[model samples]
Target: MIEQPRHIKSIPAYKPGKSSVDGWDGPVHKLSSNENPYSPLPSVIEAMSHAVATMHRYPNMAAPELTSLLAQRYAVDEHEIAFGGGSVEVAAQLIRAFAGAGDEVMYAWRSFEAYPILVRGAGAEPVQVPLTPKLRHDLPAMLAAITPRTRVIFICTPNNPTGPAVGHDELRDFLTNVPERILVVIDEAYGHFQTDPSAARGIDLFREFVNVAVLHTFSKAYGLAGLRLGYAIAREHIQEGLRKVAMPFAVTDIAQAAGVASLAAEDELMERINVLVAERSRVEIDLAIQGWNVTPSQANFTWLELGDATDAVSAHLNSRGIIARPFSGEGIRVTIGDAAANDAVIAALADAPRPSA
Candidate 1:
């Protein structure tokens, strides 16, 4: 028999959003993946269409044009940027680059989900610090968890399925406390939807901290989820490791073209992001008014702390054609999509019995 590591076999597979509901055939509102409701921009579509004709050739390995555009926009050196199929892919590469067997990777409990998975997949022990009472990252505790074996730390601001973000001052203090040699990855996949002035800006943090690496994706605010394009910004040594571990030409020519076009249309894209931000605010406020304990969200999605009633609430929403992400006994995360979807979600919540914690 072929031997498999116990940890590898025990690792839970990542669950993607459900697209269909049993016993229901209604038009479903896919609020599960946290995708932008808007369609791809005209310019981006045109660029991608143009690139499709070149499908016969392999994509550029370095993605120099897209990398250059991102470098110029973020005011970073070309060497500081590394592109991937998505931030998730980049994250895994970083994990493999910095950590290995018997090493430790640390992150908050109930964060991006991929953190523990990637860490364990890289043959590293995962140290998950619990979120604070307010459901925010307990950074002080995370800092304390660091030992000599801890190789990488992932900080997901506006933490997925929890909603609240870590404040700038707190992060700065934590980063200062951490040893300089340790790698601290700041995942800002939803940074563009942030309306909070105090939210830790990962790009700025990357510029300030030599050990810091910021991961960003075009999948969120740029409405290019289908394109699978994302990049990481880090110091030279870290960037080199990421580049070395990365799958060559993982980002296709079409994704690169679309990403560049999306960056060029930032003003228009920001407008759309602002709309989603406003919708998220409204949803949280409305949920609060409806006697639901909704976490204050700075991302395109808000989290409902349903505790024991999480599954029931999720079932109710699904019956109403609103597909959301639920964490069994933990909570439900509802994404802010188009107006109709938002309306459906609100209506479902309004009709739900007050969830029992």
Candidate 2:
């Protein structure tokens, strides 16, 4: 029998939401994975269709066109951009390239669920700092956790599962204190949905800080989740190292074409984001009225702090043909979908019996 490494044995795999299940009859409204409910921009559809005729040809390994467009849009050099299958892939590459055995990677607990997984996969020790009571990343705690062995730090702004983001001043101060040798990653997967002006912009930080890398995805606000296109912005040297480790032709021709088109349709997509933001605010207010503790989210979802009722609420919602992501005993994460889907989730909760006073 082949003996696997000890690290592989202890590593816990990431569990994404189930897309479909056998024996399920009713329509399932998946508010589990935070994907854009809005339809893909028409320009993307057109570009995808155009690319279909050239599937026989190999995709451009350099992703030159998309990288150029992204660099221009972000006002960074093209050498600073690196493409991956998704932002998740970029995270893994960052960890693998900079961190290794005996190295420490620091991040907030329950921030991006994938942080520890990626760190462990790279054979590095994970230093998980607990989130503050307000569900925001405890930057000070995370900074304190950093040691000389620390190689990479992940900051998930408008963090996954929890929803609250680190503010600009807080991030600036944290970056100032952290040593330049430690690579800092700002995972901005849901950045476009942020309505708060005070929230930290990853790309802007990337420009000012040589050690920081910012990741963005076409999956959320751009409505191209299925295409699996994401990119990272960092210093030229960091980008060079990440690109060396990245899989060749990682971003498909169709995905690249679609991403380029989506960039052009940013204005229209922002309008859709505005609508979802409004809906998210309404949902938060309504849930509060129903006596449920909800985190104020700038992302495309809200974290419902149901306490012990987490399981009951999740089961009840699932029974009603709705699916939400339950983080074991912590709470439930409900993604913001279209008008009807959002209404259905709220209605499901309203229909469930409230606890005894």
Candidate 3:
């Protein structure tokens, strides 16, 4: 028998949102994963289709064209960027690069589910700070949690599972007090869908703070989840660190081509995003009118802190052919789907039993 390290064996597997419902032969709307309801833009499709001819060869590990385009778009130096399989993978690389045995990585709990998994995989201690009752990151609390062993801190804006973004001024103040040696990662996977004017733009903060790194993925607004492409922007040294730890040829040619095409078609893609934002607003308003206290979301999903009633509501949603993401005892996160799907969620929740006071 072989023995594994305690940390590796203790790490819980990441559970993704469910894709199907049992005993439901009817039409299903998968709101479990916060995915774009639309398919890739035609221009992006064409680009990927053309790239298929080059599948016989290995992809350019440097991804030159995509790098140049991203650099120009974000006004960052070309050397300050690195690609990953997804923002999650980019996060894993950061952990592996900056942390090791006995090091501590800090992040808000009930945020991105992958944080602890990545930190533990790197053989680092995970220090999870609890969110405020309103489901927002407590920056001061996080700052207080830091110690000599703290190596990395992740701030997920428009935070997953529950949607609320950290405002710019508050984050600026938080960064002012954090030690420069600790790397702070701002995960902006859902940043594109954010509608709040006061939310901190990770790119903007990345410019102001040397220790800051920003992560963005094409999965959300760009509708490239299946292609698995994400990038990180940081100072040249931090970028180098990430690249040093990155998997060789981690990003494929098809994804690179699709990224270029997506940028070219930004206007058309943003139009679709506007539609989803409007739908999100509608759902929030409707839920409020029905007496449900929903966290005001700037992202594409809304969160209901149903507490002990979570499982019951989730079961009801399953029966209605709507597969929403539920966190057992905590709450339910419903992605804003197309009109019909969103309507189904509203209808189902309206019929769901209210939790006792």
Which candidate ranks first by TM-score, i.e. highest? 3
The TM-score values for the models, in the order shown, are 0.98, 0.96, 0.99
Candidates 2 and 3 compared: the better one by TM-score is 3
Task: Say what the RMSD of model 1 is.
Answer: 1.1
The superposed Cα distance between candidate 2 and the true structure at residue 120, in angstroms, equals: 1.0
Give the Cα-based TM-score of candidate 1 against the true structure: 0.98
Q: Which ten residues in a row have the lowest lDDT in candidate 1?
A: 348-357
lDDT of each: 0.89, 0.88, 0.93
**Deviation in angstroms for 10 in model 2?**
1.3
In model 3, where is the ten-residue run with the lowest total lDDT? 348-357
Clashing pairs in 1: none
Higher-TM-score candidate of 1 and 2: 1
Alpha-carbon runs more than 4 Å astray in model 3:
none
Model 3 lDDT per residue over 1-357, tens place: 899889999898998889999999888999988999999998999999999999999999888999999999999999998998977889999999999999999999899898989999999999999999999999999999999999999999989979999998999999999999999999999998998999989999999999999999999999999999999999988988888899999899999999999999999999999999999999999999998879999788999988888999999999999999989888999999999999999999998977666
Task: Name the lDDT value of residue 195 in candidate 2.
Answer: 87
Give candidate 3's TM-score. Answer: 0.99
Please give me the total number of clashing residue pairs in predicted model 1: 0
Better of 1 and 3 by TM-score: 3
